[model samples]
Target: MTDYDIIIVGAGPAGLCAAIETGKEAKVLVLDRKQEIGCPKRCAEGLSLRWFKKMNLKPKKEWAVQEIKGAELYTPNGKSIKMKAKKAEGYVLERKIFEKELAIEAVKKGAKILMKNQVIGAEKKDNEIELIVEENKEKKKITCKIVIACDGVDSLTAKMLGLNTKLDLKETDSGYQYEMTGITGYDENLLHLFFGTDIAPRGYIWIFPKRKGTANVGIGIGAYEKETAKYYLDKWIKTQDGLKNGSIIEVNAGVIPVGGFLEKMQADNLLVAGDAGHMVDPIHGGGIGIAMEGGRLAGKHAIKAIKENKFSEKDLSEYTKEWYKLSGNDLKRRLKGRHLLEKLTNDDFNYLVDSINVEEALRIGNGTLTKKDKTILFTKKLITRPKLLKLMIEYARD
Candidate 1:
């Protein structure tokens, strides 16, 4: 049996970030089921530079493949709106490389990492958490003062702890992506987003360039769609001149939890971060930044609890409180916005694209519109579409 101050169940960005923070003053150990870190890649790999700046970290050249200057949004009627801003510029990363670098940083901070290990069960004993893990085809027991479940959307740790991480079908998006080579006619410094019922049903399609000649072409569909993501992605790819002849070098698929952050992310001696806690952006499906933030916050509070020698649910509630203070309102607004969007029809989207300019579209996407801006936009929209306005009001109240 092995023991540590903290044991993280997943080796993704969130788990690694927690280890890096907690390892500063606590004995931290991270475990993953994969033999190698960042394997079986399953993300679009786009990250905003704003997050890196906010985190006081520099963009790593080795992990970055392309710098994005802006994004183009295409409506159902083929009208496009381009959005560009200093804060919106980002990078398309090689996620495998990025995740590995995070793990290396955590180790450098004195965190021990054990790959090819899966935590099968967890139990609370006194002030410590006992974890049953499978390593090398054998079951092993490890004890820890605290456990952070940074596991992905289907987190077994959260389930073991009896946390309500259940996601309704409507709250999740089925996503699929193809890393293609020999692709042409794409702006290497820009992202393209296509929205239409025919293209992606209730969700959207995205083209995130990785390099001059390669890109991560993907589509996400709401669970309400009967067709699979691959079907829609393939259908859209056929209509694209640049991607029709491109060769797929890699394929990745995953579920994105966009329901909103879980109301509760902690239990005695345990904290849940990342997708397990549903920290993903409801509108854009961006999670890497939020997941890391959650992990860092979890680590900070966990350390505080350890120093006080208190590992109760009440003691760990500080993590949830702090996280809400930082991002709670923003997340609530996003959920409201997503709900409003879900009520729109194809024609409604077309009307919106025709009515709003690039800057307005960007503001909506970034959720940076001022109250006055929204009032003006909504007043004009309501005059033209009273039914939609009623639905928006309903969503807002909800």
Candidate 2:
């Protein structure tokens, strides 16, 4: 048995961040099932630089796949609008390099890294958690004072521990993306989004450029009872311009929990970070920042629990509290917006595209909402129609 003060499963951003923080205060062991670190990337790799600036972290040269100035949004009717940010907009990260750097940072801080180790299950007894990890046809046990489950969306650890991981179909977004070369259209380093039922059906399509000639183009659909992301992606690709002439470099499928943050995200001597805790922004489907933030909080709280010699569920709730304190209201507001999106018809969205043009022209003259730079844009139906807003208010209030 290998003993550690804290054991983190998964080597992605959340897991690596947790390992980094925990290793500073205690002996930490980090494990990943994958043989190579950060190979076979799963994300669209877009991240806001604003979040990194606030954390006082600088992106290395390898981290930048491209620098972005802003984003352009397209409604279902083919209407488009572009928004440039006042500050540096974001980065399209090289996830392979980004993930590897996190592991390197953890190793620099004295955490042990185990590659190709699959944690099949864990046992909890006497206030300690014993993890069963498999590597190369051999099984091993790792005992630790606390377990941080930073596994991605479909986490076995959370399921095995009896945490509520069930997602309402309406609350889940099924997504598929392709990495491609020879992509056309100008590389503004701008992320492009296409929204409407016919296009994405309660979800949306995105194109995030990583280089001059390469991009990650993907689509997501609301989790309907019988539909899968592949089905939606296939249908959507046929309608995209850049992808029509491009060849697929790689493909990825993943689920995002966009309904809202988990009502509960902690258990006895354990904490869930990232998608396992449903920390993604409901509106944008961007999660790395929130996931890293959750990982940081989980690491700090785990250190506190170890120092206090208490690993009760109650003690672990501190991470939950801090996560909510940091991200709760934002997620809630976005969830409200997301729910409104689910109810919108394609025609409604089209009407909205025309309405926004009117509103933008009017705002330019008076400079009211346009002056403030509409952070959240409600469609014409949501604004002109009181009934829809009332419905959204009711849903949000619940």
List the global CA lDDT of all models.
0.85, 0.78
- The TM-score values for the models, in the order shown, are 0.95, 0.89
Q: lDDT tens digits, residues 43-144, model 1?
A: 888888888876666777888778898888888999887766565388998888888999989999999999999989998887788899999889999999
Q: How far does residue 10 in candidate 2 sit from its true spot (Å)? A: 0.9
TM-score, prediction 1: 0.95
Worst 10 residues of 2 by lDDT: 364-373
* Cα RMSD for candidates in order: 1.9, 4.2
lDDT of 2 at 77: 73
Assess candidate 1 and give its lDDT. 0.85
Cα lDDT tens digits for candidate 2, 290-316: 888888889999999988998888777
**Model 1 residue-pair collision total:** 0
